[model samples]
Target chain A: DAGVTQSPTHLIKTRGQQVTLRCSPKSGHDTVSWYQQALGQGPQFIFQYYEEEERQRGNFPDRFSGHQFPNYSSELNVNALLLGDSALYLCASSRGQGSEKLFFGSGTQLSVL
Target chain B: GIQVEQSPPDLILQEGANSTLRCNFSDSVNNLQWFHQNPWGQLINLFYIPSGTKQNGRLSATTVATERYSLLYISSSQTTDSGVYFCAVEEYSSASKIIFGSGTRLSIRP
Candidate 1:
């Protein structure tokens, strides 16, 4: 059984540009969540998707949006990126929702140039 | 929103040494998890301990939900264990959200 997988291991974008990162959840998992991990800090919750709809969200702004496909894969799109947006974008998957164990991917390293 | 705090932001130890990391939350939590971020920035789940105590080889975790704190113990540390240890919690209010602590950076020297 493969664990969570993320595409575009690393990326570089300029301010005001948009970027989309993708994730494939672990086998047998249905819930996907996104997190932002700034340098020297812990991972902060971005949002979560379940059954093709957003179930919960964090304190992030509207520029940060996500989608969940029927297969349980997810995409995190950041529009008008800022220098402050440069961080490791991590995607985690769980069996359902609520308080459950999570399996995380390696993460996409986004650098705003 | 609940507050999560971790102690000993940074630690260095020789191989075979032992260490303990603590996490304190502001309110009672229904879920508590520990993760280790490897050098490559991969967040690996270490424990899913909401309450009670669990031991896995050289690693063990104990969560005192009543006290709103959790402890992660590492025995006979190895260089492979060098990474940032983070404590994440989920309160009953939010179903999908998890609040994470700053984490403890651990460096094990061989």
Candidate 2:
């Protein structure tokens, strides 16, 4: 069985531009969550998608958004990216929204230059 | 918002050493997990221990929900075990959100 997979292992974007990162959850899982890990810091929750809708969000602003498809894949979009947006974006999948176990992907490294 | 704190932010040890990482949360938790972030920045799920103790090979974790704390023990560490260990907790009242601790960086030298 395949674990969580993310696209574009590394990316480079300029300020004011928007970028979309893709994620395919682990097989047999339905919930997807996104996190941002800045240099020298722990991963911070960005938001969670369940049932094709965003169920919960963290302290992030409106610039960060996400979507979940019927197939349980997810996409994280960041608009008007700033230099600080550079970080490692992680995607975690679980059997359900409330499932205690979370399987994470290798993550997409976003470099805002 | 719940606060999560980890102790011994950085540690260095020789191979075959044993180490313990601690995590403390400010509120009751319904779910707790430990992750090891590799050198390449991949978060590897270590354990999903909400309560009690669970052991997996050289790694073991114990969570006391009532005390709002968790401990991760690594025995006979290897250089491959070098990484940052993080503790994430989700409150029972909130099912879709998780708070993560700063993490403990462990470096095992051969």
Candidate 3:
């Protein structure tokens, strides 16, 4: 079975520009969450989407937004990117809205120049 | 908000040795998981032990929800075991949000 898949394994964007990373969740999973991992750091929760609606969010700014399609696929958009935005953007999928095991994707490496 | 802390920010062990990693949370949680991030930058799920104990191969994890802590034990470590081990948890207040600790960097030498 295929695990979570993320598009644009690597991306580069200049300051003040915007970028969108996509994710296809694992089979039979409905919930999707996004995380950001800086160099030499652990992944930090960004937000979660369930049933096409955002369920919960972390301490990220408003510039960081996400969308969940009916197929359970997800997209993470970061606007006005800054050098600090350079990091690995990870996507994880779970079976339900409850606390369950999550399957993670290899992640998209974002390089904000 | 729940807070997670991992002990021994870094560790170096000889091959065939064993080690234990600890994770402590400040609040109760409904979800707890252990992940091993190899040098190649892949987060591999190790265990999803919210409570009780589970063992897989040479790795075993036990989560004591009542005590708000979890421990991961690695036996007969190999050079391939070198990586960052992270403990993630979700508080009862928000099940969708999973918070991660700083992680324990483990390096096994031959």
Candidate 4:
């Protein structure tokens, strides 16, 4: 079976522009979570979605939001991107909304100019 | 908020050498996972160890949940093992959020 998939693999945007990254969870998974990984750092939790609603969020600003569809796919949106937003966006999916085993995607590299 | 700290922030070893990485969490967690991010930036799942020991090939991990610490042992490391290893945990109060440590960068030279 195909693992978690994310697209576009890389992206470029300017300050004040809005960007949306997409993710498709692995088969038989029902929860999707987003994370940000800056250079030289570990992945930071952005938020998690289950049942098409946001169940939990991290300490991120309001400008960062996400959505989960009926099919368990997810999208992470960053409004008014900042240069500091340039990082690798990772998407992980699990069987449920608890602390379960996770399957991660290759991640999308966003570069804000 | 719970804290996850990984140590030996950096390590370099020759092929066939052995190494150990430690992860310490601030509180009790329901789940703990280990990931190896390759040079190509893929987060490969290494272990999903919550409170016991599991072995996979030459790699093994042990999580002492009572002590809130975990250790990853890599035996006979290979050049392909060069990457960053991260420890992530999901605590009871955090819902389903997983917090990751800064990671240990391992470079296995051939």
Candidate 5:
């Protein structure tokens, strides 16, 4: 079922540049969530998308924004990236917003130089 | 906001050995899950135990929801089990934010 698919397995961007990472949820799944994992740390929730709208947000700033499509696919866009933003970006999908049994995709490793 | 904490920040064991990992949360949660992050940066779901116990082959997990803690037991550990184990929780509320603990790094020797 491809579990969850994330695009651009690796990305390199310069400070102040913009980057977008994409994700396709598992089959029949309707909810998508985004997370950022720094080295040696567990993933931190960035936001969640359900019904093509953001339902919950984390401590991340507006520079980290996202969109979910009708097909339950999602895109994470970072504007004016900073070196500290370099990390592994992960995408997870589940059946419903309340469900916690998530399937994650191989994250996109973003390197902000 | 909920706080999740995992014990034994790091573990080293020999193949065929058994070990246990613990996770504690600061607040009540509706769901709890365990994940293993491989070297390739992929999170593989291990268990979705909000309460009670579940066994999957040589792996078993028990969650004491009333105590706000969960435990993962790995028997006959293999080299492939060498990775980071994380415990995540979904706090009870209309807006669910799954928070992950710092994780316990496991290393198995051949």
Candidate 6:
């Protein structure tokens, strides 16, 4: 098992630019969730997708949206990014129901200048 | 929304010392997990403890669900144990969303 995997370990963009971070969930998992972690802080839930549909969302703004594919992989897209958007983007995956454990990817470090 | 809080925002101890980190949640949760984030920013799974006691090697955890608190104990710590420990929980009202605590920064010195 390769575990959860994320692409573009590091990224840099301008304040108004858009960014997309991708993640591949672990095998035999059907749900993917995204989180944001700023410096010296814990991860904050962005949203979660199941069966290619967004199941739940956190208190994030409209600029943050996500999509889940049939394969259970996910993409987190941020538009009109702000300087405050810079943070470590984390992705976690687990079975859809009654699953207590989650497998997390290393995360993408986004630096907005 | 549920809130998670961790105690002793920062801790430093000698390699041979033992320490305890605490987590308190504001509501009932269906799931709770402990993670160790290394300097490289990877959240390594430590334990998925929701309501009881579990031991793995030199580390152990006890979760008292009725009190809405959890404790993580580390024994004979090493320098490699220096990292941020986080407690994440999924509120029973919202099963899919997970909230994380600010975390306790643990540093074990030689």
Pairs that collide, model 3: none
What 10-residue stretch in candidate 5 chain B is worst by lDDT? Answer: B89-98
Candidate 4 similarity to native, TM-score: 0.99
Score residue A93 of candidate 1 by CA lDDT. Answer: 98
My TM-score estimates for the predictions, one after another, are: 0.98, 0.98, 0.98, 0.99, 0.98, 0.98
DockQ of 3: 0.85
Chain B TM-score of predicted candidate 3 relative to the true chain B: 0.98
Q: Which residue pairs come into collision in candidate 1? A: none
Alpha-carbon error at A93 in model 6, in Å? 0.8
In candidate 6, stretches whose alpha carbon ends up further than 4 angstroms from where it belongs are: none
Q: Model 6 — TM-score against the truth?
A: 0.98
TM-score of chain A of 2: 0.98
Fraction of native A-B contacts kept, per candidate:
0.96, 0.83, 0.80, 0.89, 0.80, 0.70
Name the docking class for model 4.
high
How would you class the docking of model 2?
Answer: high
Residue-level error in angstroms, candidate 4, position A65: 0.9
Q: Write the per-residue lDDT of candidate 6 for residues B1-110, one digit (tens) a residue.
A: 88899999999999999999999999999979999999999999999999899999999999999999999999999999999999999989987789999999999989
lDDT of 5 by residue, B1-110 (tens): 78899999999999999999999999989999999999888999999999999999999999999999999999999999999999999878635699999999999999
lDDT of each: 0.95, 0.94, 0.95, 0.95, 0.95, 0.94
Better of 1 and 2 by DockQ: 1
Q: Which model, 1 or 4, shows the larger DockQ?
A: 1
lDDT of 3 by residue, A1-113 (tens): 89999999999899999999999999999999999999988899999999999999999999999999999999999999999999999999998899999889999999988
Q: Which portions of model 1 show Cα errors greater than 4 Å? A: none
| Runs off by more than 4 Å, candidate 5 | none
The CAPRI-style docking tier of model 3 reads high
Q: Pick the candidate with the highest DockQ.
A: 1
Candidate 1 residue-wise lDDT, A1-113, digit = tens = 99999999999999999999999999999999999999999999999999999999999999999999999999999999999999999999998877789999999999999
State the displacement of the C-alpha of residue A26, model 5, in Å, after optimal TM-score superposition.
0.6
After TM-score superposition, the amount by which residue B10's alpha carbon in candidate 5 deviates from its true location, in angstroms, is: 0.2
Candidate 1 chain B least-lDDT 10 residues: B90-99
